[model samples]
Target: MKKTGLFYGVNTKKTAQIGKQIQEAFGTDQVDIVPIEEAWKTDFEHYDNLIVGASTWFDGELPTYWDELIPELVSLDLSGKKVAIFGLGDQAGYPDNFVDGVGILADAFELAGATLVGFTSTEGYDFNKSRAVRNNQFLGLVLDLENQSDLTAKRIAAWVKQLKKEWAE
Candidate 1:
């Protein structure tokens, strides 16, 4: 299997922590954590499989670094790449726009021609609205570290397992 690049914003502690957990779950040999702070277009183009994550900012906006990288990311031709997104949000605090960063990133990757994977059910979340949801399922893994911190590990493990299967196909 090709090594997966796990890219995330290093400034956000929670998102970075979650990225680390994902790397550990896949084992360092199979996953590499790349800080979005230091990432270049080549980083996105180099990996066939990628796990990218971000934290949702106020009013459902993506973090600063991710927001700034949007144009560059959209310009890429990721025709055969596989991307799985994960986001950190406070559902109880931002119910109206829970996990919007995931949706935003998902859209950028889709526009770049990546085959997105790891769509998860939106069953247990309590939110009024979210762009991340489509057909009643989340675009990717959604972790509410504020309201659902206990479930983070389990969710990451399950998502990684799902990615392994999806990437195989």
Candidate 2:
């Protein structure tokens, strides 16, 4: 199997920790954990499969690292690439816009011509609204580390399992 590029913001403690957990779950050899700060347009060109992660900031904005890199990322011709997205948010604190960062990244990657995968159901969440939701499903996996930390590992495992199957198709 080709190794996946797991790109995330290194400065984001929670997102970084979650990225590490994901890498461990997939086995370190199967994934490359790259800090978004160090990723270039050419770096994305190295892998056809990618796992991108983000942490939602105040008012449902993406963290600076992700926000800054998006323009550069979208500039690439990602026609044949497959991208999956994951995000961390405080559902209880930001119920109005839970996990909007995932949606933002989804749009950016779509604009870049990548095939987005890992659409997940929004069951068991207490959010009032989100940009991440489309056709009644989240554009990607959503994890609430603040209110639902206990479910993180299980969610990641299930999502990774799902991604493996989806990518295979």
Best by TM-score: 1
TM-scores for all candidates: the values are 0.98, 0.97
Superposition TM-score, candidate 1 onto the true structure: 0.98
| Residue 156, candidate 1: C-alpha displacement in angstroms | 0.9
Error of 2 at 39 (Å): 0.8
* Steric clash count of candidate 1: 0
Per-residue lDDT tens digits of candidate 2, residues 49-150?
Answer: 999999899999998888988888778898988999999998899999999999999999999999999999999999899999999999888999888889
- Stretches of model 2 off by over 4 angstroms after superposition: none
Report the alpha-carbon TM-score of model 2 versus the true structure: 0.97
lDDT of 2: 0.91
Which number leads on lDDT? 1
